[model samples]
Target chain A: MTEPKVKDNDVVVPGEELASGMGYLPGQGTYRDGDKIRANRLGLVHIDGRAIKLVPLAGRYLPKSGDVIIGKVRDVTYSGWIIDTNSAYRAMLSLKDATNAYIRKGADLTKFYSFGDYVVVKIFNVTSQNLIDLSMKGPGLRKLEQGRVITVDPSKVPRIIGKEGSMVSMIKTQTNCRITVGQNGVIWISGEPKNEIMAEGVIRKIEREAHVPGLTDKIKKELEKTNKGEQ
Target chain B: MTYSKRLDGRGFEDIREMEAKVGVVKNADGSAMFRMGKTIAYAAVYGPKDLYPKFLQDPERGILRVNYNMMPFSGMGDRVRPGPSRRSREIGMVSKNALLPVINLTDFKNAVVDVFIELPQTDAGTRCAGICAASLALADAGITMRDLVASVSIGKIGDKLVVDLTYDEEAIKDMDVADIPVAVIPSTGEISLLQMDGIISKEEITEAIEMAKRACVKINKVQVDALKKKFEVKKNE
Candidate 1:
């Protein structure tokens, strides 16, 4: 029989022993040395059947295919734009993938996507070496305008979005604001100044308390309190 | 006369009081503060991001760069020069090697992870404290590390062996003092760093290393707790 040292959902540090036996298998963020499984990162330990996994508490964003991300045009290339995906790797948005319409070879691409402009786009392909290709033809993929952007820890994005987008939807309807959350942790809010501030505040709150239990309820209550305060 | 009593009246194996806190630097990816005796070390971890000056990029894996600095007025001696000095550069090099073994940077090829360790105040064992703080910050930043590195200064002051030595202990006049700063990987009892000054007999040095190993285990406990406390605070609140 395997000996499990930590229970599920327990916070573990690097090199901390999670279990001591071959009955359990090591998963992400964990490795087996001899008969002991040790944590390789600072995160929550999860024991699932025969394998143990980890959920990181904080980390930099690593781009993956089919993820909706917010990027800034760092350099306008000859045939595409170099986008900083707020990650270690930069992404390329070729002219063909930039839009549906055809354009001349020497045409100015800045008119479509200029430098220092933030856009919400979908990553279409990612090479093993982390060369990312982006596409702007999908829905809600467009340049962000005048509203402010806030970046939080990429690891907390899922908590801010909630299950099936319920948390975000509630915030949208309650604050009466339009918000787009990028997988890269960059979020855009567009609405009246006061309401937009409230939306941003609520999102920030979620990011801070992402590790705590019953977060969805606490956030809903917070939004209600703020809404009542305005009236 | 044999050095029977510590100046601060602590036991031979006892270390100074330690305090550790994580996530103190809000803007940094990961940050921490560690205190030992009167010394304080604040470390911030940034990156695994793009490394510029293309010549330095490594295709195999990312590089770890550590910069250990002491504020001009924070030194135990005279005001330290504001920038990198011969002493600080050596400490920085060892600190990088101290932490490099545990981190896996293969996923971040051509990138860099920079650790900046700043000391606001110090009594002794400042580099060791800085290494301890750097370990906590790396964990707080969620970097993939095989283990945490815990460090301390184990010394032989006169005829007595000690776990951690203060400036007064190091400055004792006409005493046969050996200040040995050691960094150990707690899990494996592996020494990542070892440096010494003054004199120590072969048998005594071996014994001091054994003591450092145990002291490291204690320090590692504090580092682990600092990382967990970052999460526990949220639950309590």
Candidate 2:
């Protein structure tokens, strides 16, 4: 059998040949071109069994169904609210899925969610043309209030959240802040003035060093150091 | 008068001293700066965001829009106009076509990806430099691309053939000078962009393209290095 040209976690650019054998299946950011696997984007190589894929390092947030996101209400239409999910496509949060309350149509829809308000929403449906359908009727999905909102690289969201929320939970316990990380990279933090600022700094640090080795250990140490300073 | 030696005291196929850097603009989705000889080009990639004109939006794939601008004082000659001109407009369109073959924008439907190339200093080969920089920025932005496009100017100076032309060589009054800006996909040897000014023999055109393809192979190495260096920084440092 022919060997793979690239190993796991190798930095690869577009058009670089990964492997030229039929034994490999092409995954995201990679394609099979006449029995040769080639990368179609700049990312790290990930070999999963018979499939080879790439983990992107940068790009705009791509909206996906069943993803919780933080969005800003750009326009309040007659039937629903138009939300900007920090993506190329806008999401429509209809009145029926917006809230459990039953209200009459054409009677001040902005009363529920007005313009420029930030809300936590869950995308329920996405069309082939990229039309997004949002629903606010989920656990912990509501309009954010009095919290500072910031954005990070969506590609690093999984790292910031850590493996099964371990990384974020550690930060929350140490900083005593409530942090909501959106799959789209929008984050909301609310807590005491001093702790909230600390939480934001930690999150930004994670974003910067997401690709660094021993990232979890480094973040844990940094959080403890800040906690000692506060004592 | 016969021309035997190059005006810059360099070999015919030699490209000038070059340097490239990526992620120069902090706020842009992806950005880069490329400098060759006296010419310098900066390119920034933005969007895949909402397309402004509703009619221009395509349901199948995103569109690429390139804006090429030469700063007013970039050239040694008279000041260039700040806004878009006929020359810049034509270059922008050609540059867009130059990059379209390599970039895959199918993931972003009904959106637009904008690449802005600004040159603060230039001697010659300005559009070619801009194309090289834009290709690097697009790849750095993590746009799905089949390959990176590298560009250089192949000049036919009098009876001599040159890989990259300097301003002095183009301005030589006594002999015929032909400037050909060509962009190539290094992996495939496909010429995505070709533009010519002045005159050259039919047989010499093939030779010029081959020379450019070689120079572009060397230039592609620099582009690849600039991107890798961004992520290579150690976290402890």
Candidate 3:
């Protein structure tokens, strides 16, 4: 049987003892003491391998090509409705991409999108000048309903979702929170009090120590412990 | 002199308690921090990152961008904004010019190098101080360059040329005659950057240039001493 080694961030080299029963390779270094613990690539340790890599499952809000993000309408102009994509650059929902009907040259565009409404739209393109073009004519893309929104670092969205939706599915089963993780680092969590609290705690914990190893197991243990206590 | 002013028991031409330190920002590609009397500046260097978009890439030398920012508390009063304002833009240009001669940008093709200057306190002659700080930062970042650049500001007050000006002296003093600002590579005695703002005669400018050059040579020694101290401290650490 292979030994499970702990992975840590400070280890500059691979095969170093990260924690108890855990070792880290510099890059996607791996060992399978009992289970397959292999690294796929090298990056800053987001979470220690011994623990569950609890990626905060929130909808990614980063402006990317083909991502349908929910943005707040900030301004209305003759050409388009400016939407705040929660990025350094604002996304413009042009009248042309917004609807099939022609937006008059001098009509009140605010009627289409009020200041506070959350509109779901796909990013068609992002110019080098930081101009973002948004299109709303897509499936599962429209105005967002009432739900609290949260944000995380855009880089960590993939981890929150886990490989093939494993991590997020676990959270959904455990907490019953109807959560959505955006590519732009935004998360929408809506559910019962107990479920919302559990999800929020899990997400917050992930944000604080995503660089540590063995995050997945740690999160699982905590959640299981909480569940058992409730029973 | 019409207005007799004394600083630290020295005449008008004297410089204040000046010191330089290198390798201050460990994470930066290169870094140097300095305190000229009350003035303090930290400089960091990054890149030869590839110039974005092939069109912006230079065929010959790399593009150099110098950013100078004064911390809100860099002054005696309120804290400042992070981004560059008008004053910082002017200083940034001067700093870039100061380091130009020492850097052989042509060596790094299609690249862009950046220098960031953070001034925690502003006395006088920050431009020159920034130039000197940036050169050391560049060296620490391990960027290949011809030599270290040193800068000194020579301001005239009541017919005497001061090596480094203090805040009060710079503001109240009538610099009707232009002051000489020069950055030099002391090793080869090559001029990197030069500017004069007020209206001084050609003869006065020439004399001020000579005076500024001499001050920079002295300042360069301080830069070397600071680097040696840094290495000694690092060895112990």
Candidate 4:
């Protein structure tokens, strides 16, 4: 009998293992001795077939239509508010979308989103000219209060967060700190001053050594050390 | 009248205390910061992205763009603009030309490879160090290319060529006019970047290039060592 082939863009559940990447399966994807398959794609793996099919994880953050992101209000324009989305392009959040309530024409825009205020917003539209239109209406999308923000390498966010939020969940459990890990490497940690410090330290340590192998062990060791000292 | 070598208790060709680091900036796609003695350089690579305009896009391969900037505090005496200057512009263009020969641009069609170099300190061999740092950063960013590029500046001073020159040495030495900065792909013995400043006899230029090539080969080992050490530390962590 012939082995089943996995198609591209196929969604698979986790723990299924990946059989091959898109197009053609590379020589390394196939196991020499058994039917086991190595993951070719970087996403959820489905093991429904005799072999495993790979489903890709969430793609990198592109300013998609109606997607919500927290933006830092940069410059206030006469007609709109310019936000730095931490992307290559700057987004404009007009006063019309700044709030659900009606905004008067030429009204004071600062009342909605003053400069440097972080606001959760949705991308209403993205133009070919790299112009991004934003709105401030969405669930769990609102202004962020006083919190310490730290940046990480965006590519390493997955590794930092770990599988199914296991890494961050462990950190929160250990430090007793409320942590928000933004997709764009921006993290906000808030809680008691002591827990906040511990969480920030752990995050920075991970940020510094995230590229290293055996990171899970390192994070586990760090949290254990912190726990011992706290106890 | 003066027959003795300078303080630091070293010969003219001796390199100063060298320390190199990779991946300093978190935001850059590829980043490295290296310092040799007091001279420091930070390089960032963000590219293989879509080209801006249709006319500027290359159908066959990616276009490499390099920007070199000397921060105002790079020097003790003169503060330069934060942006690119004439010298930096020329250096950037030359660097781009140098790297293009090593990078497989065709892999990234219709995209642009942009490299930005920031020199936080100024010395005689800033450009050469900048090139080396940028190469390492590119490698750290996982940009598959040809072998790593290594560069060094050798100057003729007091009728002898030195491997690396400090700011004071370059400024004070007016008698020897020839200065050659060469970049080599150490693995393949390929000459990707070569530039000479000041007047020198053809024989001296050839000698300098040959000497620089040998120095570049040694420098390549250090580059490999730095990258390997970085990964080794990561694996242990």
**By summed lDDT, which 10 consecutive residues of candidate 1 chain B come out lowest?**
B101-110
Number of the top-ranking candidate, with DockQ as the measure: 1
Instruction: List the TM-score for candidate 4's chain B.
Output: 0.92
TM-score of chain A of 1: 0.95
Candidate 2 positional error at B106, Å: 2.2
Q: Write the residue-wise lDDT of candidate 4 on A1-231 in tens digits.
A: 334344443332211233433433323212211243433212333444344443333222334576556678899998789987765457898766766787777788788778898776778797644568987766666777886777665545667688898889988888887777766556778788888988888887876675565677778887898689877
Q: What 10-residue stretch in candidate 3 chain B is worst by lDDT?
A: B228-237
Model 1: residue B5 alpha-carbon error in angstroms: 1.2
Q: How close is candidate 3 to the true structure, as a TM-score?
A: 0.49
**Which window of ten consecutive residues has the lowest lDDT sum in model 1 chain A?**
A222-231
lDDT of 3 by residue, B1-237 (tens): 544564545665556678888767755656789878888889988765556777987766678899998887777675677677898999899888877766657545566788999888987778888887887777555454545678887776666666776667656544343456788777556777777766666777778778777777778777767654543442232
Q: RMSD of candidate 1 to the true fold? A: 1.5
DockQ, prediction 3: 0.02
Judge candidate 4 at residue A106 and give its lDDT: 76
Residue A21 of candidate 4: its Cα lDDT?
38
TM-score of each: 0.97, 0.97, 0.49, 0.57
* TM-score values for chain B across all models: 0.97, 0.97, 0.88, 0.92
Number of the candidate with higher DockQ, 1 or 4: 1
Error of 4 at B200 (Å): 7.6
